[model samples]
Target: MTQTENSQFRIECDSMGEKQIPSNVYYGIQTLRAIENFQISGLKPLETYVDACIYIKKATAIVNGELDCITPETSKAIVEAADEILAGQLRDQFVVDVYQAGAGTSHHMNVNEVLANRALEILGDEKGNYKRVNPNDHVNYGQSTNDVIPTAIRIGGLLALSRTLHPALDNAIAVLETKADEFQNIIKSGRTHLQDAVPVRLGESFRAWAQILSEHQNRIYVASGDLMVLGLGGSAAGTGMNTHPKYRDRVVEVISELINCPLQPAPHLMAAMQSMAPFVNVSGSLRNLAQDLVKISHDLRLMDSGPKTGLKEIQLPPVQPGSSIMPGKYNPVMAEMTSMVCFQVMGYDSAIALAAQAGQLELNVMMPLIAYNLIHSIEILGNTVAALTDKCIQGITANQERCLEYAEGSLALVTALNNHIGYLNAAAVAKESLATGKSLRQIVLEKELMTEAQLAEVLNLEQMSAIRPLGS
Candidate 1:
């Protein structure tokens, strides 16, 4: 990026005029215009998105070669250039901002320029030799910014979910499952409306969290199924104009083979062009997951709120110091991180919903922003979940004695007497326990409601927190 501009730079021309591009980079004038035009986030698109673009480029070359639209030699050079990109070389060449032109036209052109220049170099031609391997004419044959971008976003999003996000989720789920088993014997006072209610095993909470992740993981896979249908051969407007009749299937075949995922042409090209429902569906699942995580993180933070006075039922591992002035203080930084990530992901979900609705006429121009938000959210959640699992959830320990003390003193334990003693008698015992600041057992025995043996049999602590509550 610090390379000095010089007269030796290659001159590239487009519809606008000619400009000198850096000699060392593969990008061209269009990419340069895009870089200077939208500097909005300073951050570039994710590498998965870049790889998706490469998939499209490689597939297009293969299909073009088979169709005899371009010489096999030209296809070979283009594919080789794209291969380098897929393999993580020339990543800096994709310089366009994620917030660029809504249709991602700038990015699509960036890909074309990079591949064209590299192909030109492979053909023993100088840079900017458009006559040899023009970026648009030869490299981007039978494609448009519209179809190409939407398809790439799907490809990239699904790739991120399977390749990165899901693995992180699995790790978190495994940690939860292990913790659930470890804490199965630890009974705690369950809170309803923030008031102590009845006995419940701490293990159940962990199991529920694991189940939430497992369910939502399935939902993501189901939503991503819609991504398999692509609108590739639907040139400019999805009318399939100027593309060969078999080009759609052939391109999909080549892409599927390259990515090792089964893919098919969109059932309806025009509808696919204008509709972003697939991305929305995927984001919906993400939104659900984020919402659930927010709740889980908050609950963990509350449980870990104080070693002195708060719920004190659990202790989140202290990954960092809580305050600058306070000694012997540590905070639930991991839980706080997951909570923040969940909020940001929910915000992204809202934006994706709005963008999906913003589509109009033949194409949705909101794709660039959607792509940025969706893919970024996916990656952030993946990393955040992994951190929480490693630094917080896995290291968390239950305050077993504290939990038992709360359960022993709770006035709510009087509910267990309702079956043996009359309802009125049980209610009186509960009121007496609350009024005298005495334990439920003390009040029940003092009231002569039942003998100690009957009380022990009827008020079985283990039975109260069992999978099936007694008499229910």
Candidate 2:
């Protein structure tokens, strides 16, 4: 309805009551109520999540127009509005907090209202003229929050992976692989339980991390398969209530073509709507990646610990001053930031796990929480990984002199003499070397453990650090 007493506000009526909505906004009464109620988190919905919802609305409108479920004009108007939104218009209309109503009804209505109002405007009608383009009747023809929210989550996850995470992982893997090849001949002391154990080619370390990231990318891809099976046609409670008989398959087909992804209807709409396993599985994969990233970040910090007093085996590119009081000091800020982002991702994964299992008989009230956490986790983790790659991994430079020194001075070098002098004798040589501050070669030659030629061949650092080709 148009504003009666004031020109700046319009009255929007709902079943509960009427509220005066700001005339300038696209969202309506329900969204306003949500804004008022859930001021808990000032955070807005993630952009990919909004895009997911808009895509769903567009697909539904297309199918409904074909089925004559809604008028052709109304469907056209809604689809056009959706297109405008997708083209980066009217984003601020999605104002409801991330912690809104259960099953994301508040946010769902927010989308419906915005599209409805915009469609109304497209048809030469006012924003609140539900009689012309009703939010519930025309815009949301055969859907309910129960089905739409979960399906949005699916689309959002897939979009995030394709647009954000997958590319980041690819870049990181490429950087690490390049580093592996560049550092292939640099040998360093390998540590087990933080003590020197053997020699390792530094390139092998980078190669292993590259392989880890590749595996994580593969796991995420595998987990995303479940997201393709959508609960969209479930409608109100998954009974296909009030939907056109052909709407299920047709809508999924339209959505698949629209998103350019191969999506299918769920075998059991109720099961798909009720279970949050797909999201949980994807989030779990993210957590797995995050854990590995933390380990890698810590390894970088340890390797680049100090310039004079610590390992100093490698140097990370200095992006910014590390300490205010200490000039000429640089820190592993990129790796540190990566670890921080990864820890947040793990936290989001935990919240997603709890929310997934919190669903009850018909629906889960925790969908909003899951939606925000899962999508945000994917985006932030992806961004962090990309930054780590560009800032730290690509710019790393090896300290060949320091690495060689550590490799040569390591007492574990005596490990190679076991076959020549026997275990007890090799152990005695190591003990004496430690006691007398002598080198392993010096002690071994003094004891006449083996001929110099034999000792030199056994203790060859390059041979000891030679990395066997994977799968060999």
Error of 2 at 214 (Å): 0.3
Candidate 2: 10-residue stretch with minimal lDDT? 1-10
Model 1, 1-472: lDDT tens digits are 1123564577777889877788777999999999889988888978988888899989999899899888898999999999888878888888898888879999999999999989988999876777868888888999999999999988898788877789999999999999999999998888899898888889998998999999988898898899999999999999998787888999999999888998998999998889999999988898999999998999999888787878889988887789999999998888888989989999999999998899879999999888888888888998888888988999999999998888777777878888888789989878877787887777778878789898888777788887774886
Question: How accurate locally is residue 444 in candidate 2, as Cα lDDT from 0 to 100?
Answer: 79
What's the lDDT for all of these models?
0.88, 0.94
Q: Write the per-residue lDDT of candidate 2 for residues 1-472, one digit (tens) a residue.
A: 7686767899988989999998999999999999999999699999999999999999999999999999999999999999999999999999999988899999999999999999999999999989878889998999999999999999999999889899999999999999999999999999999999789999999999999999999999999999999999899889999899999999999999999999999999999999999999999999999999999999999999988898999999999998999999999999999999999999999999999999999888899999999999999988999999999999999999999999999999988888888999988988898899998888878878788899779999999999767997
Q: Cα deviation in Å at residue 77, candidate 1?
A: 1.0
Give residue 393's error in model 2 in angstroms: 0.7
